[model samples]
Target: MSSAADSNSDGRRNRGMLKSYYTQGENSGDKQFDLDDSSFKPDQYLDFLLKKSSLNELMHQEEEIVQNIRSLDSEMQTLVYENYNKFITATETIRKMKSDFGQMEEEMKALSENMDNICDLSSSVSDTLQQKRSGIRKLAGVHTLLQKLQFLFELPARLKKCIEMEAYNQAVRYYTRARAVLNQYQHMPTFAGISQDCGSIIYELGNALKEKLRDSEASSKQLAEYVDLLLQLEEPADSLCDEYLISARSRVDEKVQELEDVLEDNSVDILEFVDIGCNGVLSNVSLLVVAYNDMFLNRAKANTELDSIALQKVSALVKEILHKFFELIQKRVQLEKQTGDNAILVRALDRFHRRLQAMNKLLPTAELATLATEIVYNAAKDRIDHYYQALTDHLGHCITDIRQALAAPKLISSNLDENSSTPLQNLVQTSVSSLVEQIKAVLANLQAFIATDITFAMKSTFRRPFCFDGVREGLVVRFLRRMLEYLNELCEKPSGPATLLLLLSKLATILEESTIGYLLVLVDEQFLIVQEGDVQFTNPQTLKDEAKAAAKKLLNNYVRLEGQTLSHMVRKSVETRDWLNTIEPRNVRAVMKRVVEDTSSIDSQVGQLYDDMEEQKKDRGSDSTKRSASGLMKSSKTWSFTPSTTAAVLDNSAFMTNISKLFSDKIDIFSEVDASRASIMTGIIKIVLKTLLECVRLRTFSKYGLQQVQVDTHYLQMYLWRFVQDENLVHRLLDEIVSSSLHRCIEPSLMENSVIELICERG
Candidate 1:
């Protein structure tokens, strides 16, 4: 009570001290600090602060003041830390500006001197040329007249020389200038002959220009130059433009056909194919677009422009040619549907994407350039989808293979030692290595894909989720979901005991031991790492927990299947017999030997298989095995899946029902899987014996048949002791079978206990 009173009193003192440091302002609930309180006409603000407050309160106020000072100091330091680089940059900029001002002053003085020198030189030159200007002007006219006469006399010969030199551009310039003068005086004999000769040579130059335009080997610049010359010659571009466009179309076609031929060449691998696309087809088509644009769309400054009608025609053709070229680029770069193992095409798609980026940059104004880039980006997405689809199909095939293997009769010629290898072990390891190899190849390809830098302008527009956080998480999720789907297909029908358990062991071991670690390496080293320093791509431990749970569920499923198979065997043995008519029990029936022999096989397969089923529990931080599972596999080095709740991973209810029918007890089947193999085996053995007892109670046994039942029960009891350490469950089950047999016996006779033990031992 005193502490609470002291705390309240301290709070009041602190508030009084705070208000004392500054004048009292208006209350917040009223008009706030708007009241004129700056005049220091305050009343009892400090009446209790200095005169009545204790030394402890004063000391407390001083500590808070010191703390505020420290806080302010910390804030000042934070400001400096945040803006230190900017402060240093500002200092350097100021220094540089000062130095630049000094240089500017000197440059201004030099500029002023140069201007004065230019004024003086201009004055002297003007004085020097003043007297001779009239005479020089008069001679310029005479000089022009004489030069024209000389050019007319030499025009035909010069035109001939130009034709031999293939200087059509120069020839056209010369002939067009001369034609005006020749026509002015064509009535005179000399002028008319010059005009006639020039016309014929000009005709030949026109023909050369047309031929040059058609030449597919002509460079873009050469084509533009030829088109310009023809335009200046007043050649009607309507038909000529059509021909030119056709020639451009033919060149693009040739490049596309060449690419097609390369595609048809099976000997050329994907990398080579991508190379041809970038260098040969991609470059050629872009060049054709550029050349066509230059010739038809670009207006030359000095040459006569094409008429509006002709330009519209040419523009339409240009659009057609450009659209076709882009279409070709789009169709060619699109990757085909391939299996997941073939995701190396991602690298090839990246190469094409880069080339398309160059194309867009080369012709940034063309709508086609941007469209082509977008198309290629979508193609990349489609390729990734196809790769995943292929992987799904590949996994489906693997599941099918397991189904076929399970359908065959299971045989184990020998017992499996934990340290020794078996076909099942080898097969599981090989499958894991095969999958990891596919993932490694995919990682390699996608690494190259992400390494490709898109242009800043395209980056926002073309950004894909391919590299967000790490692609590993999404990929792993999809992969695990599909695999779970395949596993569920087996669960839909009742498969044999070995089938699901073998698959569960193989898959769970690979997932926890090999796959999860590979994913970590893939994200950390090979793929994009998130900068936030969080393992959001996937948390290793949480995923491990989930995997552990899933493996437990599979174990329960296998456990239930084991019980069903054993019970089935018992039912078959009991149902096939004619218990009412039989000979004296000869050396315990073959059914008991079959039962024990089958049980021994179970011991060997399950003991080894469950050791495998107990997968991933062992910190196999030691990944033991690697093998190649495909002809396409390069080597053993690279290798490269479920769920929560009851979706598919846990088959709790149905399994529980089947188990309840067998055991007649409310056993938590799921809880039992965590115990030793002996407990589980004992539970299943007791279930099978109980089934035998149930079969005995249904029948009326003859005295010999009763003896047969006694022998088989004793035989099962003695031999099965090797499997179950706890004989209590086995004893209860076997004893019940004898009592039921005695009750069902028509003669009501019984074999001696020692007689029964000796008969079972003799077998």
Candidate 2:
């Protein structure tokens, strides 16, 4: 029993210890029982169990938990501090890199500024150097001009002495040398201020030298000396003075009077001096007076001695000077001929020609007219002849050059091959073409001038009818016909584009007035010939009858040609892309109207002639009819007047039927053409609309006075409704009419009526 008690107590003690251990670990019974529950709330159980533990023990345990928490917090703080240091280091490095980039950008900007400064300085230096070089060049040119002027300054004195000594050759040589120096100086690139003064001095010196020589010729006692002086002065004076200088007439007259006094006294032993001086003075005075009568008052004396010995001397001198001038001209012409580049020579020739023309202009009024006409005629004839000669010469030269080029051995193969497409060949072709065009142009101009002049001349000279007598109408008609024929020929020529169109335009102008009449006559004639047979003259009448017949024939031909020509034009217009829209229908209508008028006129004339014939028959009375009937009976066996019963004649001879047929054919052609010209059909329709509207307007106006407020609105509406059925056309027509009415500011009622009428007519 004792042993059983001991075992039970041990078991009880073990259970208590186990229970205590579990209870210390878990405060709640549920927690103590849940040993397998890993998600149990230990903190909540520990707090509950701490309230039951010893204070010292609990305090120690609490200290240990607090220490653990503090250690974890310190570790976390160290890690955070290390991460912050890394972030700070990265930010510092980024700032340092940015600083470096900023420094580099500033350095680059400074370097760029330095480069710009350097370039600017270089450009400034270059500009300065160029300016200096230009200055140096200008200085050099000034020095050269000064040197030339120095050389020219010594010329006048030498020329004066030569003239006094009558050494013409020496005078000319000096003058030429001075002129050459002056020319060289003029061309030098010096300061204009310096050159202008020098040029004036040189011109004055040249003029003075020439004047001295001219004076020596006019007053010198030695004949040989005088002639030499005059010859020396002639060319230079003429060249320098041209027509600008007024000759020293007072000095010349004084010298002449002194010589005459000496001749009368017979005390002067120098007979040659008196004779030569007197003659020279008189001749020069005469020439001067003739050239400048406004300056000289010695015309009466001049004219008195004009046929005397003094005049003969003057004439001889004049002839001599002219000969020299012509010789110089011939020499220049020869030089030009040799050089081929003759621009300078041509200019010189033109200058002289202009001087002659000016001289001709200065003649007396009545004499001037005759002189001018003669001169113009002669000059024009000469120029025309010269042009022909020049053309011949140039052609000959070209042929020679071509032959030479062809014969050259080196050019044999190449020439033959390239000649087929050579520039020379092209140039020749171009020249020929150009020449042909120029000839046509000239001929056309001549034709116009001649047409105008001849018309005027005929009117003036043939006022009394010289050749045609009373047949002036025939003469004028023939002239017009010839002119038309000439124009037609010109139009036929294949001139180049510009010239051909110009020629056509010119021809149109030249024939404008005559053409209207001619066209009318032509249309009439063509219609007549095509409708009726050729005109048949049964009996010859007077000259008037012949003239009338001829005029009728001409009219017929003109009308026929006009119709044919118009037909061609119409066809061409239709074939064009934008035909009727581009063409002015008014023009076509005008031409058609002309043709119609012409035909109607001819018909009226024929009717008049028929009436005249009937009148003549009546004048002859019943006897004449009886004779006519008897004669008809006698010739009945031979001429049975049995007109072929083929077509029904509307009139006695079917003339009206034929005329209708001809017009019908033309209208048919026009309609076909219009049908083909689709693009222009709209334009044609518009024109038709306009015409119908106009007709309606005219009819309305004629029927109703201007003040009539009441218009036939229903009639207009009906017409518009019938004419304008297409919706698009109706809208277009309405818009056009409205816009036109707005522009014209027409009364709304009137415009509305017109539009309605147009629309109805169109429908």
Candidate 3:
């Protein structure tokens, strides 16, 4: 009900405002009435109008509203009539255009059918014409291709005719052209038949040329033709030509065989027979090279521009000759292995070496020259080896005799028995001097063969059984080393026999080298010793005893090695056979002095250790005391306290273990000695006694400590007895042992001091 009333009120307010707008009279304030509060109260508005105006105002406003309504309704009707006429005219025009479009489409449909009929006729006629034109063009292309490739079609037949006519040059031309075509079209099946035919022809050509090369009685011109044909073939022909030359080398075998027969008869001179055999082989090889070169002079000149294939071919032939030559010599030389007959055989070998050296100069190729060099070297080396073998055999029993003499001190005399005609004396002075001259001659020839540089020359050649690996020194150097090694063993055995020493000195004089001196240096360098840092020992007394004994034996061996052996060798020098002329004994004494100095160094080290332990003990102080009573004792003393005080072992100082280590380390220092001779042994004993005394003064010890020292002294004494067993030496050593043990560790009474003094003076 309120909504209906409000609608009626809005309608009344709108109508009144409309009536005021149309009837615009008098009050201009009524034109701007407030409509913001649109909640219209019609009765209130009517009352406001009634209070402001009369009924004439109301009638006049209603008549103006009717006039404005009539004017708006007429204008709206005119606008609708105009738009409706335009709509009728447009509809009529559209209907007329639709009829014309339908007629045009009907005419287009008929025209399209007519054109379709024309197109069908044109398509049929064009297909026939295009087929004819394609056929004509294909025929033309076939005719043109055949004309362009007419040479390819005739190439196989032309090649066959040329080969049949023995026109090899013409055939090669056709084959070369055919190969070019095949290379261009090889992937296509059309060329396969002709390519196979070409391959067959080439194979036939090669076989024919090989047959010509195989002909034994062929002249140089005939051989040259085959060589030229093979070169024209220009596939890798080195191996093929190598085989042909090897066949040519068969002639040398016949010559060598004849020489072998002559060599076997023994009536023929061996050197003359070898010369005949080698010259025949060299002449045949030279002829073979000349024949090969004459046959292909032009081709050879051309190929020489790249590599000397001709030289390679001829060098291969030369190698074949050398092969046969070595085989013959090696067989004959192998049959005669008697050292007594080595000189004649070696002389024959030297002749062969000379002939090979001449041949080496004649050869043009480096390969051939290298081959000749190898042949010469082998010959020279065989001679040298044979000569040395004879020398070694001659000296064998002498070496054994000398070794037996060296085994005992008085078995062999150091001076020559001038009145004696023993085999050893004869072998050393006579046989040995002659052998040294022979060896020198052989080595000189060898040095010449290798051109004074064996390593560089022989490195690119061959190595024989006696060759030293990585040796820069020549064959003589190695041979000298080997010979000296064998002789040094013979002569240096326990003051080597004087004759052997004399032979060594003679060899050194002959070679103008310090032969024995260098051998001594090699011995010294090879002197295997326990590196001082590597000599280890344990705390166990037995193990330390074993270590000390082994070390003593090694030191004695070193002493004997340097003193008796090396000193005797140097003393045997012609200028130094006696004390007045010799410094060897003095050198030995100097070595002994150096050994004493080394022991003195050990004494100083123990003294330093003594002071260090004193310092460490002071630092170990009351803390060490609270832990164990053994802390107050020296390291060597605590071990004597037994298993009952094992906990105190750790608290004991490490001084004694360090001393044991020092003892082991000091033992190695004597390994510098090669031998302990009579004088060397006495010097060593004095050093050991002084060292023991130093140990005594350096530390305060319990009974066990003194016992350890005594045991060590006894072990050293026992080792020394093996080299020196003098009773006075043993007695004096034992006296020091007892006095040091008693006066130093056991009891130091005033009365015993005199006894100690007497023992010390006796020592």
Candidate 4:
């Protein structure tokens, strides 16, 4: 309490001194300015000190602080001494552990050495026991050798007795065992005598087996036994069997020769020759399989059944024969390809497919049928592939001619003369004619192959899940698709004006339309039409339904493929920017006009077709009586009007329905020409508009030139309006063309000069 009172008194004195300094005017408005003032004296301010009582109080406070520091220093020394003792104790424990580990390691090393010594001692004892066991085994081997010798000595007598009794199985059993032993011991001096006797017995057994196998009069079972015995006797009868099978190939060769002669002699029908050749192959393969079994039954493993073996061998042999036959066919096809007689090759392929059907029926098992069918299918595919390549090659040659003609510059006349024989015109005509013939031939061949060969022959023979007739169809369809690609490439080039493009597009249009029609005809001819009162199709089975479905699928594919190709060709031609390639306006106009006229004519053919059909309907009405009489005369009295025989006569209604369906099926493709024409006209208009815009911006045309262009532009707008009926677009184009032309004629210079002349005249 006394210290508190003294501290309060000192604080009051310090406050008193601060109040005096402030009163000297550091913060006051009025201030004393006496030189004698302590606040104003600098030395007096530096001498700031506490009162004497305050100094005495501070010394007392310093003594207390010194005592507290001495107390903390003592506490720190105690903590340091305690922690140092703990650290020293931990160090001693670690040192002791290290010494103990060293001793343990030395004891472990001695224990390992002792174990090694014990293992060596036990191994020595084991070696001694092993020697004794080997001695016992050697004694046993000696006894086995004696027994083998005894068996070898008695084998010859036993074999002879078995052969005498015709116990071939027992003989085989004895011979197998004895031969195993003799071959095992032949290199040993102990069995030299037995080896010689065994060899002689083997020779005799082989001779007997050979004599038995050579007897062709033996039954199949008997021959099988002899073959087994010969295999046991180790003779070269395997080679003999192969030779026997090979001998049957001579018949194959003879048939092949006859077929070749038929191919050379057009007098012989190819279909008949194919039938004979295919039947010959089947018979030859069958006979060869039988002979192979008879000669090499033992070639099969011990557990394999004879029937299974026969099937396997027959399959393999059939594959071989088919391979060789297909090879010959391929060579002939190659020759036909070279001679440009693809028609004959196509017919041959068709006949071959028919023959393949016959052969498939002749096969005994599904597995064999599958193999044979696939083999022949692949062969046909290869041939068809080659045919497509030939078509492509021929087309390539024609395209070259077209390109050559295009390289030459010949103006097309405004008035098309039928007798004009310009080099380019003649060249295009010849090339197009040649290509048209080739395309027609290819289409016919493909149609023939698909309709007669695959649909009727192959598909009928092999059911679904095993048949690959679709592959053949796909081959031809895909080839047609590929040909369109080539045509598109040829037509897409910017080598000429729309004239060449127009011509090629027309050719493509012809091909597409004709192909569709041909396919429709094939479908109508090959598949059963849903005629009136057709009970067979009322509840169609899997086969009939599948056939119809396949036909529909083919038609769908044809439509899609043709539609895509036609649209692509038109678009590509329209986008071609080589408009300036032909500078003659008359020539350009003539080509464009021809294109427009061609499209109009093609569009008009639908009406013409309908008219023709109407005329036919009229003709048929007039001849209805005669047709009915002919039908009655042809109808069999015993034949009921079943689904197949019903509707022998086609009415105008049915014909019209078919024509409508045909049109509907191809509507997408048929509409492309009009669509393409509009697109091309728009493109041409855009090019003209672009040129007119450039002229207006550059201000390079005179009044007369602008007027002439305006007249021409008006004529063009009128012409294009016939194709495209977008009145707004036409108005916009006209506005821009006329406005820009006028702008170019009324230049800034002219405006300035006119204003100056008016101003000067007014002054």
Candidate 5:
């Protein structure tokens, strides 16, 4: 009603605007004519008094009339053009109605004349029959009675034929027509026998119909006819209605099951699959309710008292069948996790609801159409929500599956590519590639659905376009947080070996340099959510930058990781020696050679990883190396960078005393390194070398042990010289290692730099 009123008001307002435009020339209210006023009175426009106005004014009025006539014609044409289709339909309807009415009039007149003639004939016949009325009535009664008796005698045979031919309707009509006559003449044995035979045939027919209804495979149309036949047999309305509803519900159930079990095989087109379920359920169930209505509800509607329990049962089953079908739809939505044309899917659901609504023409009170629509719509809405959640879950699942794969034991080293020399190399290869592959797969999958934003129109205000952007942001945060946390964990307690820690650090770098930027490209292209002056969420560009910082942090962790492993090797070498009875140091000890070689390898791996970050850096450590191949000179220059957290984990008293003795006076040692890979790695070497000095201080050494320490320091200083920015820093750290060993040695003879350099060089 409100909508109707609104439309009427809009029409009136439009009409008034057209009226105002039409009357703009006629400014005077008294002379104004309504646009809809079709009558034109020339007398009103004509000035009868010849001297009332000047000739020029009369000529001007004539021009105005001509202009008004042209304006009216234009307006008429425009209105007709707009309403052309309506005008054509109205003309066609008028013509059709005239033709039909005229034809009906002629037929009515002809029938009237025929009725008059028939009346005359009937009166004449009645006059003639009045004298012989008794004779005619007696003869007619005898003929009718004989006809009924003949039909009764033939009733049994006709019913048998009907059963054989499956013409149950014809048989019922034949039996009903003879029932009263048979009952009236039942005293005669012959009539009684005929009635008995007809009754037996009908009993068999009723059994046959009930059996058909019980058959689960019976088609919908067959079920309808079967119920109809039983109802004609005067089957109890309560039982019959109950049976019909049960059978209909079963048929609906089968279709629902078929949709769940078969249609979702995923080979069919989605729209076709949805349509199959809709048509199958709708057409079959329409037959259910329609046939039920005809047999039972129609009678109840006609004011006949039916069992209320039957009515309620019918209502409950209808609701049940609908709910079951809707549950199937819900399951399908949930199971269809793959993102597709959501518009088509949602529209298909709506089409299904519309088809269900067609059943309202048969059963209006159930409102299953409206109910089903809500269920299917919510399913679609929830499916979208799940799409966003699936992205987050996908990231998490990737991490989890990777962890499980790493946890699985890999004893067969040969299975790793032929290039892999050992199990650790294989671990590095698989771990790094798996993480990269997982992230790449996630981004690729994200690309599929994030751009195709599905619209949700039911809201009163605008909704954000499918907040997959938020999901993308979550992927960034989760990948960073989870990956960094795992990296930190590995650095702290490397699960396999130190190689695993380096691999994780490499993975973190990939995230910072490549993967995070990829994610941001996808996120930034969507809605301009962060207005210039408004508050913002975690902006993707900012996140892209932060990932770089995280990469550096992981590198520092890598430093601590290698430092621990190398420091352990130093301790084991010192612990295994018999310093009291040891022979003279020949060249450098194997442990020192291995440590020097591994340090060079570490430098190359870490430097190459971040080489591009600083293209042509001046090697400050190389300057110190050029000063003397002998070793780093003890300098009073303050230590330029703070040691990593590895240093903080140990007590400073022994380590502090070692540092104080190595320098002439204690130099300030706490300084921060830049978060570049080179700076970070230089800090790692300084800390690890200092750790080596601390390990030396922990042991007691004889003369050869002290010489071995000096040889190791010279070789390390020579090779590690080219790796760090502040060359003096590495010199000071290796010098401190020798100084600390001398302090602990029982016999303090040290190898000269010339001798140590020649032995390291020649070997």
Candidate 6:
């Protein structure tokens, strides 16, 4: 049993062992497979571990990145905030500046308003001055009327007194009263009445005296008859009565002797008294006659021991008085001729009128018209009737003498003709010549009178509205126009030596009155209209026509005068430039600016005249053919081509050279007048620059042979290369040309660079 049991145990052990071996093998296989799988699982585990670690790291990194991003965002936000703050500060500054500018604009507006107010104030002051002037004018008109009344009522009685007695005292009292009235009128607001009253009273008194003298003569004659009758009727007288009569006669004789002695001591010569009396009536006439007589006597006694200066003074006084006298007499004569009543007076007046008409024909219409107006104004009423009557009586006596001479058998028409030239012609010539001479002589006196009257009027209580320039210019223009007309008439006469000399004298008188020193300057400058050796007019119609034409021609001559004056002024100012420097810069600037503007205006007017001439030529259809014909015939034909030829020939260098030469000669480059220089240089420079620029552009573009393409480096380089080769020479030429041209063109004050740039852009 033990042995069997051992065998079984052995077998069981083997089986167990085998079983354990199989289990182990299964386990090993499982393990191997598991290992293989575990290997992948380890990799997976590692990957999982790595993934987990990576996940942890990624989470950490994500957290870190989020923080970093937040930090970066914060920094970016800070930067943006700072930038925004800066922008706001800049914007605030800009806004403040804008507000300040707005305030400045408001201030400027207020300043403008103040300027406007100042202008309004100035205007108000001007208006007030004008109103004051107007008020003064009304006062003068009323003063003239009072003078006329005094002349008519006072002077005749004093003149008619035969002796210095009670009548003379009464007349003197009346005259004194009239003079007091005149003085009172002069002191009043307006002296309107003084002139009229004085004139009328004197005239009326003169007439009244003549009537009084006649009445006195008649009374004396009647008294003489009565005294004779009384003497014849005388009866036998008592002794005592005779003794009384003798005593009375002795007393009367003694009184008469005393009176005679007194009269002899006090009395003047009869002729001297007569002269004094006449002088009182006609003040200017008597004085003038006396002066003339003195002058004549002085000349007759030229070799006497009298002072030459005194003689000259007498002659001057005579001339001055005669001028006044002639003016007064002419006025009176003209007045008388306008109105008359008697047939003889009427006939005399008619003859005088005819003579004036003939004179009017001889003189210029303008002068004649003025004279006629003056005559009409002086003779509007019957005041001149007495003078006309006197003239009629004298003329009637002359007519009677003429009639008797004609009726005489020895008298002949030929003799009459020999004695006098054709009465109408002779009278016209004489009267017209006399009038012209009188006008010349009176000019200085009239000027003095006008100046004195104007000064007095301005200061007087009865002041008239006056403008210094307006009144002076108006009077001067009127006087000059009248003078011009007279000169025209004189110029129409035949060029006789005497007539020529007379004309020169008259012209000299006009020069003295009008231009003074300026006329001599004009003559020196050869600015007068009269040329050397011009023919004088003879026939009346020819004279009239020539005068009219010459009058028109004077416009151009006057322009020359203005030009010369301006030129002289400019030259003088330039010469005295240093002196001008002392003046306020603004004032100098203003004066120079005004001079420039005036010069420009003159140039514009001259240009307008040229344009008008061109228009006239066009209207006449004479320019083209005449210009062409002249060009063809003239030596200057090559250069004096028409516009068409000019355009065609402009391409020719030689032609351009010739043209430039011609232009240079005709245009004064260095003219002191800015306008002249500006016009010429501007035109030439513009043409030359335009032509050169066009030529340059054309040549450059043609060389490229490119169209419709933007300029590129290659093309630019090619052009640049070619341009550079000639650049130095071209640049030098252009610099010289442009500099010289612009120097001539622009004002001296302008910058060269700026001018050049402007020319390049605009030329």
Tens-digit per-residue lDDT, 29-76, candidate 4: 212222233335534332332333377766785687688668755655
Judged by lDDT relative to the true structure, which candidate is superior, 2 or 6? 2
Q: Per-residue lDDT for 91 in model 6?
A: 95
Q: What tens-digit string does per-residue lDDT give for candidate 3 at 1-763?
A: 3444454456557776777677567465544443322444556666777887679997886687688778755654555566567778999999999999999999999999999999999999889887698888899999987864776767777777877787777777667756777878877776776677777877787777677677777654566566666666664556556655755755556666677677677565566666777677656655666665554333534565334665665666677667867777676665554433434554565566555556655555635445544654465456556655654654464455545643553323223222433333333345445545554454443333333233324433443322322111233334445554554454346344333343333333323333323432332233211224543312223322332333334334433333333333322321222212222111112332333344333222222211133343354353432111121122233244344653344233334344544644232213332221333444344444544454454444444444433433333343343333242354344444434443344321111222322332333
Q: Write the per-residue lDDT of candidate 5 for residues 1-763, one digit (tens) a residue.
A: 3444454456656877786678778655433234333342346536342457688888887788799879866665565565666667989999999999999999999999999999999999999989999998999999998997788888889899988998878987887777778879888999889978888998998887888887889887788788877877778878877677777777788877777775557566556767877778767777777777776666644434574565577667777777777776776666565764455565665566567768766666677755754665466446545544554465445545545544555522223332334433344455556555555554554342223332222221222322323334445455556555655555556456443444455556666666666655555554223333443556545655555555555566667667667777877887777766777766767876777667665654444334432432443322333445442433311222133532332234247645666665542333344545566557666766776777777888877887777777777776665666666677667766766775676655555657777777765
lDDT computed for candidate 4: 0.48
Alpha-carbon error at 578 in model 6, in Å?
12
RMSD (Cα, Å) for all candidates, in order, is 22.7, 38.5, 29.9, 33.6, 15.1, 51.3
What's the TM-score of every candidate structure? 0.54, 0.18, 0.34, 0.39, 0.52, 0.18
Error of 2 at 456 (Å): 29
- Is 2 or 5 the stronger prediction by TM-score? 5
Q: TM-score: which candidate is best?
A: 1
Ranked by TM-score, top first: 1, 5, 4, 3, 6, 2
CA-lDDT, candidates in order: 0.62, 0.37, 0.48, 0.48, 0.62, 0.35
| Model 3: worst 10 consecutive residues (lDDT sum) | 579-588
Sliding window of 10 residues with minimal summed lDDT for model 4: 626-635
Q: How does model 6 fare in lDDT? A: 0.35
TM-score of 1: 0.54
Model 2, runs deviating above 4 Å: 1-223, 226-307, 316-346, 353-377, 380-763
* Superposed Cα deviation of residue 428, candidate 5 (Å): 12
Under the 3 Å rule for N, CA and C atoms, how many clashes does model 2 have?
14
Give me candidate 5's TM-score against the actual structure: 0.52
lDDT of 6 by residue, 645-702 (tens): 5434334534544555564424322222111222322222222223333332322221
Candidate 5: worst-modelled 10 consecutive residues by lDDT: 454-463
